[model samples]
Target: MAQVGHESHGLTKLEEGFRYTKGISQIPVKSAMREGAQALESARLEALRGRPEALADLMYGGRMGNDEPGDGYKYRGRGYMQLTGKDNYRSAGEALGLDLVHHPDLAAKPENAARIATWYWQHNVSQNAREDVTKATRAVNGGTNGLADRESRNERWLQTLTPELMEQLAAGRIGRAVEPPAPATPARTAPNAAADGVLKAGEKGPAIETLQKSLHALGYTDGKDRALNPDGHFGASTKEAVQAFQRAHGLKDDGVAGPKTLDALKKAEQTPLLSNPAHPDHAMFKQAVGGLEKLGPQAGFKNHAELERAAATLTFEAKVGGLERIDHVALSTNGTGLFAVQGNLNDPGHHRAHVNKQQAGEQPLEQSTFQLQQDTQQRQKLEAQANPNQTQPPPTRAMG
Candidate 1:
């Protein structure tokens, strides 16, 4: 009978109360209310038998007696955590500046329902010292009716809410703010960086062997029975492996180990294993696969999280097009000057575009810092990604 009123309640009324609990005691507001809502749902389901009238009567039976035929329906519980009875309706209405008594249906509105549920929790259960899940559940249920189910749902929600979001709830701050996971430490491959030049099909050397070993170690396979064998030769098998690695690590999928691709492979070797592989906010690995796309040509990202991920993985390298040579540009962690590239000064146009986009009054790369400066102090701090032990040359001029 209790299940009869399920249609009367909606998620809007329920979810909004997740952040409210102003007067509740020491327990974190979100945590407490989350349990409260889960417990209410459990009790509601348990009490549901068959008859709609009986369900309403069970929920509001204490307040609305047998004298009225439809009193239970008129003042039944409705909200994320369910606000019931005439007295609660009156108090909640007065507090929220709405006449819930005359129009009891208003309490079913998502916003009003959320406010009333939180108000009930802040006043009724705020004095309970026992923070045990069952104790909190009983505070709302009038008894520990669905303690087990409530605890289970509470845990599931806790895992879903990030600590940063929990902090906001604890502080009674409103709205949502998601923080990205911390980046893994940058890792480098074997020390043979001398032959770091671009490698294509048919290329053979220790560098090719090194690249093959990296792809196999990092679990990027060549679409065969297993990872490619680490022969010092770059063949079709090696190209397939390179492309797979590139796709996974947000790089261009050209299958050629260019300086940028080599840099990514080295950094990928260092990524730490994540606790929850399925976490929603895992770095957007496929953000610009098959090429840096908008993120490359010049280095930049959509947000701070992306920027940090890029900083930990990317390095500057000059590339040559059909007839013209493009200057290499890499951004610093602090959003400052690019690292000094070997042939950056040769292309005056590229140099001016990168060094000071805002000053030059030209459109810069997408999602990258446009202000360029030759800050000597900042350049002094820059270290080579390939060989962090050695210091690199300073940026002579800004590039776009």
Candidate 2:
């Protein structure tokens, strides 16, 4: 893995990735004595892992082909073990149930590399032909680059198989590369709300245009307003367009146009619906995350970031685990030199976030501010329930 990363010109962030060199996924370069192969020890492997080059090549080039292109880091050095090039991907994927063609990123991830490394050793590599090992490694580097010549590949393959090296490779330091498990999805939330067909005032933007196109494509509307509702609006015409789409798609007659409505509209339009990443609605992520449930550990993550290279942002302030009710929502925006609040809000996680922040020498943990926010939000909710006409107040956060 290290060799690949070093050779590939991975950035600092990429270098930190476990799938590449400089991370757990890297193959530890060992001492020359152990590199040539004899029964090796675990610690020996650990030490090898630190050196950029272990085998016969650190000084000149590590143990590469006996002829030229001798093993160093150019092609067949780390993780894919000896596999490289297009042919390597094709042959390896055949044995691994992976479509490496589209997902080349899979090779870099640590979990997959470990699984594939072992599988290759057990199933494909053997003692009968040391030469075949060389060819396999050579094929991986560049099928055409070395294979077209044929002569060099043949000579190298004969010397490539060193029993000691085979055993070392078999040690499983390089895990059998395989796809990682997926992340678990949060449960679906309450049904979503959308305006009914015949757009009202307010909702506007390219979104409305998108909706209009969807409605027209699905044959929901035959009018000229098919381009997009102008003047940044989801007007009466938009509402009617949605209704036309809904009825055509066979859905319940609610004025609001939601996901179901959008899908039908997109189908009608015959264009892909837009999914903006900058504003990820928690709803859309539900399905994909759910599918990832069986893949790996998730709860261990406590923040939106990993403080290092992580495949995905795993941290979200956990839902405030505990709550208490209060009669009044209040705030002291001036006291803490920040807008501070007091009242009930699920405040446990808020408390923890503050604690972690302070301990890490960041901003002081400000529970009081969060408390005020929670209070304000609660007050608003209460007013909404008590008198729908009332402008809702902000939520509060308890003091630190």
Candidate 3:
């Protein structure tokens, strides 16, 4: 029942129409098409977008017993389990003693849909459904599409259909039983009640205002150009800012300021900003930020803060001798960068330089102010030498 509810979208949508916008077209293209054949060029996909029949033919034609012209649209998915294709319709019709192939639309009717879905489930997924939801999803969906929703629905159904609840419904005592309210008692508040509680959308309070202020201070902003307003209302902008903060901190990006998210936010608030000028490695940080800004989108960094975090990880490794000190950093446009470092600093004889692939915009380990200036000059010189036509900055003199 849970799987049926999920597949049918709470028993609302039972037919496959293939109606989709340009951006949404990619989803079906990836899910429906075979691997490696799923790479439909964007321009070509856009051309087919908003055209359901054409999309159906493109995706379903030449496969799944859809050899005849318009077979794709004729035998399109229908029913709770989305029984699709000419062969499937024929087989299901035979099993249910209905002429589904001749009357495919009949599969969309509630009673017939339920029958077809149950029959399909019994034949294909019932065995796996007893083991794992993921395996059951794979059996039915050909992939784990909407697996999370399926799992959630399964859990809800399990809770709601308990033996006790079933007995109440069977005895017709569901609405008849009403328990009296308990006598009033003194309320006790926990010390960290606000910190523990979740701050989700549609909520308004000083706690939400504090969260908004913290997000704003952490350099997180709404998707729009405007900054987040600490208005005590958890609106779309506040939720967006919270989601951004969560993403930056590697938390679940659900947009709700839950206990974990609130804890992370508190830690982030206490930690100094990556771009803080007073930091010891501020010069190198500034240079990396400048380079990333100059490269624009090609640097593949969302912001300087992300780059700083990645750099910090590498810096710690180098300091502990887990990795050799970085010699040169090369930024690439493909969301990855090359770090030229020695294979092992412990073995001086092994001068073999290793290339470590790091995310773009990551900097080398922290260096002294003088060393950073020299390294910057050397990097510019190397770039100029490689691309002779490109202008370069003059090399810096060694500090006395």
Candidate 4:
């Protein structure tokens, strides 16, 4: 525990988060020297086996990679918690109105250290803090390596930081705490009202279309076999699409557009789906798309639904690996003909994607595209037969 102390009870949730994670306000200048020395010694011991180079790999993600000797010691763990790494030094400096890039030691200063740690917690961990402490810990440590220590620190600090608890402590009133409310289940609210309320399978309306469009925008192509027939209808295609989105985003794949799902959809509209910054390369991604495009439309009646579906699947696949943004899509020269379905969506990840025509089942992308195309056609035909009134016009030459 570095510079452990009590926090003011009047702090807001965000403020409390900062105090709790960063070990309260700021350590005194003289005292900070002791804390900083201790932190450096710990980091030194951890770096002893493979030297600072190994520690640099762990802290800065090999960004420096020993290219700059002594970078490991120069950019070692510092600050209220551990602002280790060149990128973090620069980022924290920018956030705190300091020039930390040149003076890395500045981040270790008592006040600067506190501000840097608080800034990191607020920006990265605050959003999910209400529901999960595990997310916050992962945000800081990258995993649950010292989860027990973190939880213990959080429990001790939080008790002193809250107004209710502080008042109880002042009055010498010690007692067991009240239990919190149970978490809400992840299911659609209404069973019958599909169009207006929870959009489930078999509901046809503008709301269903809205949901479909939202999914499509986030790379969930429920209509990948053909044009997205946001024909105001929620069928197995829509259900499967929603479930895919849920699974990718760590939600309950209930296949229902419930409030939580709807909220996530709205959030997606505002922010990119991939939270991680690391992504694949553009050229490799293009090659993978080329493979899918070569398959063309399968035994479909008309139009290139298979092509569109493949593009959507590839796009979603890239997203799962932390693609930042989609630049533009490159489609083949062929028109609406079966062979016209060649194209690639580029991202930084350089991730390769293969079209799995088996969109109706739990098949992986490793299967052949021909088999996937056959499975999709069968599922589409079954859906069409079940609802004869669901036909729609061919989609315009636009790729989402």
Model 3 RMSD in Å is 15.1
lDDT of 2: 0.36
lDDT per residue as tens, model 1, 1-400: 0111121222433311221111123122222244355553333333332234533443444453323665665676666566666777778888889898889888877777667766766766656523455666666666654343355445444545868677778987746555665886785553443465788765566888888887765545553313467767666567767876666555798889898888876655554321113422122212212123343634433334334323212211111111122234344454433332334445554421123211111111111111111122244456345566566466587687
Model 3 stretches with alpha carbons more than 4 Å out: 22-50, 165-400
lDDT of 2 by residue, 284-373 (tens): 223223322322332122232221111111111211222221111112232111111123335533221111321111111111212233
Clashing pairs in 3: none
Cα displacement (Å) at residue 160, model 1: 3.0
In model 3, state the lDDT of residue 329. Answer: 40
User: Model 1 Cα RMSD, Å?
Assistant: 24.7
Q: In model 2, which regions exceed 4 Å deviation? A: 1-82, 122-124, 129-400
lDDT (10s digit) by residue, model 4, range 277-354:
222233433433454455444322122333444443554444443444333333333321211122244434343332
RMSD of each: 24.7, 24.1, 15.1, 20.2
Higher TM-score: candidate 1 or 4?
A: 1
lDDT (tens digit, per residue) of candidate 3 on 189-273: 4234255488887566688788888877665666432368787766666776777677655678999888898887776666444
Model 3: how far is 2 from its true place, Å? 2.3
Quote the positional error of residue 67 for candidate 3 in Å. 1.6
**Candidate number of the best TM-score:** 3
Model 1: how far residue 19 lies from native, Å: 30
Residue 325, candidate 3: alpha-carbon lDDT = 43
